[model samples]
Target: MTTTERTAASYFLPSDEPLGLVFPDGAAADAPALPMPADDVLLRLYRGMVSGRRFDTQATALTKQGRLAVYPSARGQEACEIGAILALRPQDWLFPTYRDSMAVVARGVDPVEVLTLLRGDWHCGYDPYGANVAPQCTPLATNTLHAVGFAHAARAKGEDTVSLALLGDGATSEGDTHEALNFAAVWKAPVVFLVQNNGYAISVPLSKQTAAPSLAYKGVGYGMPSMLVDGNDAAVVHAAVEQAVARAAAGEGPTLIEAVTYRIESHTNADDATRYRERAEVEEWLERDPIARLKRYLTDHGLLTEQVQQEIDARAEDEASALRERMNVDTVLDPAELFEHVYAEPTAALRDQASELAAELEERA
Candidate 1:
């Protein structure tokens, strides 16, 4: 049999082995070849992934230490987040879920600002106007509808902008997701629904979430095209998003991309996956970590060396340390500012309440 056929057959078997662009350790040598990326872009992707991973780890630690209220760790899904965000233009809008801090970071958000939201100091960590990223949606699958509406607005205004809404696999079960899909398809909105299928939603696995074989095919019912990409492979994720963004910009209808990836960590600080899944399952996914796969890919292609990897690791660690220092010092938010942005012109009742809050704080001080 040919190499491609052999590779396909190997993955076709029912095994706990993960499916994605890059193969696991034993399967790496037999995996299909990947396209070569420009040296600079490849290095940048590597550094971004490294930085995001470090930031995720540090943020989780902060949550544990009570420096932040709560944080979601996207440890294994960094490739999918950074790869997709890096493929977008500055003018494009990003609708990210709670687990998508990495995408926000890739889109030029400061790490300290992201921590602000987790610290409960702000509704959104960064100003959407500055970063072109919307306030992260805590309600699952609801942001898909918002993205469609924003895309529709952009089209009506004759602007060339695409909206990318990132959601998780578990979110597919929500009514809003399907509603957004129907609306985007009907109106031909310039939106891409990026579903990061990380195996489980909290404790529920994909099998319990839906009957569909793959999440991407759900777009077919809405009369929109879709594709499944190896979310763990930065190259594949980037290429897939690049095509979807181009298509949306060119006035094509929306595209739904189900990026097949795994979450190596808990769903959030509030979750404990150990209750529903085995330690072996977690260990298995750790073996196919996305960051390590990309690192190997870069090293094999001569784009990264041991010294370069060390430097990247060091840089990420330093950035995380600095971010923690800044977040620690800047955690406080003015009680007045919360009421300040509540309305363009505060209603009589709101104004009275704001005054009362101010008076109370002043008395306490």
Candidate 2:
């Protein structure tokens, strides 16, 4: 048999459904199983969700106003975005996709910095080392390899660090995703892969993307533990990710997490979601909205009184306004900056290009 044939045959067996933690009806089958976080922690998680929603809405508006080039909003999947990051410690690193600005913000990155790439300013808006969060990745599944390498290097240096990589469901179809998982498992790299399985990957739906039972099961083939969580449930998403982060820290290697969520908005301001997905389907998902579900849970627990709710709303509004104000200002561009960060020592070819740009700018000035 050919090497390719042998490799293909290894995944012939049927894999079990991933271990799920929460149900859509606001009940958790595993909350009792894992350590419950304090009420304050839960409240903070809720605030993050609210903040994510506000950020998405504000960014989307910016795109319409011509301030932002494009935006892939995670309006419905805020729980997964915020929940995963909230689970990470200060020293841990985060690899986020373009749609995951919420996760980037949760990591303490400035909202304007998070949108830097979309604003067409630089490769990544924020300094990765400063916040321990990678620049939001525009390419699919590419950050997976980076996350694995970071975790492996940290482990090699005996530093207690783990990386959580956030990617969309469509990223699973990329070869880099498979390679990263295989390398992570074999090398015992402390990284977590959070697949925000938000129904569709741009115009393509999940059903057409893969025949596997679930994206989480993809980890089983790589010899890693897999988890499934109600992505709309902030608490469960946090719990599952916290557990995965804890496991990775203890040297249990990588984990694959599938957060079942939906993208409430179109893929971006440019795409027409109405072309492929039914409005009915979107409305159905809205019924299980992450923000609403968490708000209900908090309200029922008396953690979200009317006064507290009012304060949260006010904070979200202020943040949205601040983001709008910061983004509305025109950014001063130095055309030569494009060639600056590409290399440690600029090559002759790049040097020539930079000089040309400098001359052009001087001419314009």
Candidate 3:
């Protein structure tokens, strides 16, 4: 084949329709070789999703009780939250956004520690180095660059590592997203970018965010392969992310996945989603709930017994109860620690400011 033909054949295009293994009604799609994971793996994904949603509910309650400063709930996006992380191996890195606390917990980070940032206690609750997960990024799309850089470094060291960076639809408009995609494509970095298109970026709808047909279409501009998946379908998202990860592990560069999901709740406790969208719209997305859909599919296939359901629900409740109790306790924090990791070496001006802040706290005490 000619060089041009070879290049043309290499480019993997985004799906004409979002790839989905199950319908919104929870019926598994008709297929010969379905991309569904093994039954045990499916049960694990289902359990993670159930726990994630449980955590989301508890965190939202904390926000109302004024324990957490703020929380971006991934209520309706449980499939995306759990499934994507399930695709990763122990060594693969995860770079999550502020809205992806559920995904962080699904990655095995402590549920309480996962809320550390929202608790107004520390920058990050869990140690990033302890696992391959990075701090939950609040800035739009910046973590994509970090993921790309880390993937490049891993490749440089001749290690088989892949990084998955999660972001919202609104972040795709940011320059950092563009830079990360371009850089990853050029360098063949082992990374996967999962854009959770939850219909809105805070109050801004996707209609106002970008003119592209779908965020996955942006991959074409960067010469990167892309896939579009039903983010609410755990099996579909898990299968697609696994495919992308396997491709990246083979040194084939990055893949952009746009998971079409919805944000059932308001952007945050502070923002009113009613200002920009209608209640009917929210009601519609709630019917397509990821957790319920998976539960139905598993039950139909006889994979989910009543005993299994009760066991998963019990475990989830335990986590929520623990989160509620822990959040109720007061946290003692040291203001001086804010300057601890601000720089490799504390600058003279930074030290002076830190000292002044310390003295001010001491005087107040």
Candidate 4:
């Protein structure tokens, strides 16, 4: 047979199937058994997945209501965000982008504190020292470098900390990402660059981002290992990230993981996806929704029942309601707090400016 015929036959051959969990149309005829997790941990994962979706929905609503400055929804990418985070240890650092609030939530960051940043009260809402989570980096791709630097520092200190940096497909085109990979490969930094290929970076499709066949293979140039996985499959994402983390922790250099998933929503509250993409395309992805796939997996395995599902839904609603209530609380910031951390000792120029600002305010009052 010719090469093309052989490749086609391989896809049709049952014995030559791809090795990974497959859930089509959010359903599996014979559900595969999952590794037993502690009852609390299992429930927590379910709760987190549900709550994260609910939080994203509510935050989007708040943006429409003008209560929030702007919002980014991780509606369909919850599995990618949560699964990778659930695999991390407390000591490990997470470098999150603007859309990684779900992962940050899974990392033990308070939803209200995260909202403080969205509400524009603080540049960084959560205390990194307390939560072991860094502030969400707004500038794209720079966090990859930060993660590499952090991993290098941890390695120097002989600590077993791993750094996971999350970015979108659009960020792969940035120079900082290339620099991060080069630095990590040379220094053998324990960092994992997790790219969620949600197909678009603010309306620009992945096709426009790069001509490469796969983002994962980009690691080849830096001499790091890489893999592409079904990002919507929580099981696959969890397993892949677990393996990558192990490799990094074992002193192997960084790994680039390109998770193939769909965004299913606008890039942010300000975006109108319909303007650029057709609704039919969005609906097509809705059929492969990540949450539905996981729910079906659990249900088919008899791990989730109607009552359990109801409970999970109720819990998510309660948490989201509480978060909204907390966000409604006074979000005013102390203007002086900004200057407090700008320098160890205020420079003469800055001090003079602060004095002038204080006097101007007093005079206006």
Candidate 5:
């Protein structure tokens, strides 16, 4: 077997020691295999991180006000979201989980469109082909298969396309995740699996999810390399993902990246985080906030001034306001619209439901 096809026989855990490119103490700790980003790129990443946080905050507030049915806030995991998507080229595709709307936005999809599925309106808010982004999958790890298939097809067509599949730590436990990895490795598909290990899969802690040394280690069994990085450090996460993309593009198969981060909020608007985790744990993660950490690095190096910081914050605020304005408008639901995308032709069961719902609406009228 070639080196790329050599499966690791022993089960091992990912290194508990996380890789960090930039530290919270305002220093670049260690660079990854990929070269560090330029200062300007770093600033852009910081701005993106700030914008993602603002979007999450506003979306969470909207859920509370009944403007949205549900929101899985990525409040503390913005770095992982930004880094994974930012590393991809325009030709690359992204498959994100429902909680990773920020990644969809960062990939240049309309912010409002990214929220479409969560708004309870459509299958996806934007055109998947138009944006090269798959729907924000609500079911755990199912999108992994989609990503692998897309990447494999691209390779067969002699196209240099890589697919980045972003999933929550909880998703790592799903059976589809294993199937996707196994297939990708065997086929040498140009895909990257990014597991944002936010310490919990909803109410269940990582310890209860699996006994594997780390989610990253699961890649080794599939004959792929695995990386561990501090997900709160944007530069580190970005570099790690960038390297993985490069490897995939070179026909080096797949890489599994486990980003060590924390979820600072409840699983969703309807979840009570207090029931499962201690407030102290959340507070500790707050100190390592992605935005704050990146801001500190920029300021310490004289790359950002107070004026620049204010400007970035102002831009984020304006974007948030626009998103709120768009979401606040009431949606006009046509009872018939529900049956439109069920299939090419509606199934017998779906046709019956559509008729029943139409009759019920007509009676109210």
Candidate 6:
């Protein structure tokens, strides 16, 4: 109602099965066909998925080795993580959740800096404004409103900038998510919300998260357009995200996308998935693996050649090796650094507290 209205039908997805370009078996879907991406784009998507899965394994290994404090593996959710990044423009801002470490890395942030927070660092590793990506927010749904504010500011300044908020299904139920969606629609801010519905809010399943038909349907109440897409299909994820990004840039307010994905790994290194779920369930989702599905489709189309595969694998390995090497090295710690960023100008009381802490650390040293 703010502006840029669209046909009511366009706001709702035609099918409930989740719009998909490729089937689980690598076959293209029939009826109301979704267009496949260009060959090069598909290849790039494939490469990103492959490398992302490899990175997940490497990160998991780091956790076992005690190098990383913990890692939320995006092993099965690579499509959503990588596709969302590719859909974004360089000048656009991204507000990501902690689980979106992989997505942040895809946005060209340094891999090392991406893990600095998970490594138990005090401050967020990279500069949010500098990288154009907010810190990998650990608090649930807190950053969604930040995205809305940023997008609204950009629109007020008449800048052609958009904000993309990437969160999970669990976040849909938070008060901040509700406020963010409503305010964004009312302000007609150019922002896109990509909710990766990975079936669980920790150990709780989606059935407990919301009784709504689907997470995307949450958009209706906010007067935002929404889409439900198969998150395991990289092509569809990228295509859908691109469409949403286009709408935002066109001043169409916001779009809510509930990507139907699965959390292939447990909640984190600390959680034992088998405690609540069956191993067979995990095995079943494995067959629909995003990387394998995309690889099959590209190979059949003659897009992924043997040499290309080898080169991509080699590069991924090199990156993993470098990451492993760097993470293994112990970093020098400065106890006094914790006082930074609290205030532009330090309060006397705060200065005294910091001085006391510095003195304590000096004595310990």
Per TM-score, the best of the predicted structures is 3
Q: What TM-score does prediction 6 earn?
A: 0.95
Error of 1 at 175 (Å): 1.5
Write model 1 residue lDDT over 181-275, tens digit each, in one string.
Answer: 99998999999989999999889999998897788878878877777777787766776687789889998778888888888888888888889
Error of 1 at 52 (Å): 0.6
What do the candidate models score in CA lDDT, each in turn?
A: 0.82, 0.85, 0.90, 0.80, 0.88, 0.86
Per-residue CA lDDT of model 5 for 270-315, tens digit only, reads 8999999999999999999898888888998999999998999999
Per-residue CA lDDT of model 6 for 1-365, tens digit only, reads 42334545554443566989888888776525446778898888988877787778988899898888988888789999998888888889999998888888878888888898888875788877776999888889989999999999988998988899999988988999999999999998999999999988889889988888889888888877788889999889888888888889998788888899999888999998888888898898898998889888888888889999999999899989999999899988877787788789989998999999988888888
Candidate 2 lDDT, tens digit per residue, 276-326? 989999999989887887777677678889999899999999999999988
Q: If scored against the real structure, what TM-score would every candidate get?
A: 0.89, 0.93, 0.96, 0.89, 0.94, 0.95
lDDT of 4 by residue, 120-159 (tens): 8777888986767888988999999999999999999999
Ranking by TM-score: 3, 6, 5, 2, 4, 1
For candidate 6, list the clashing residue pairs, or say none: none
lDDT of 3 by residue, 1-365 (tens): 34674378345567677888888777887432237788898999999998888999999999999999999988999999899999999999999999999998888888889898998888888999887889999999999999999999999999999999999999998999999999999998999999999999887889998888888999988888888888999998999899899989998889999999999988889998889999999888888988889888889999999998999999999989988998899988888888888789999999999989989999999
Model 1 backbone overlap count? 0
Q: For model 1, what is the C-alpha lDDT against the true structure?
A: 0.82
Off by over 4 Å in 2: 1-33, 363-365
Which regions of candidate 3 fall more than 4 Å away from where they truly are? 1-6, 30-34
Check candidate 5 and list the clashing pairs.
13-213
Worst 10 residues of 1 by lDDT: 10-19
Off by over 4 Å in 6: 1-14, 30-34
- For residue 235, model 5's alpha carbon misses the true position, in angstroms, by 0.3
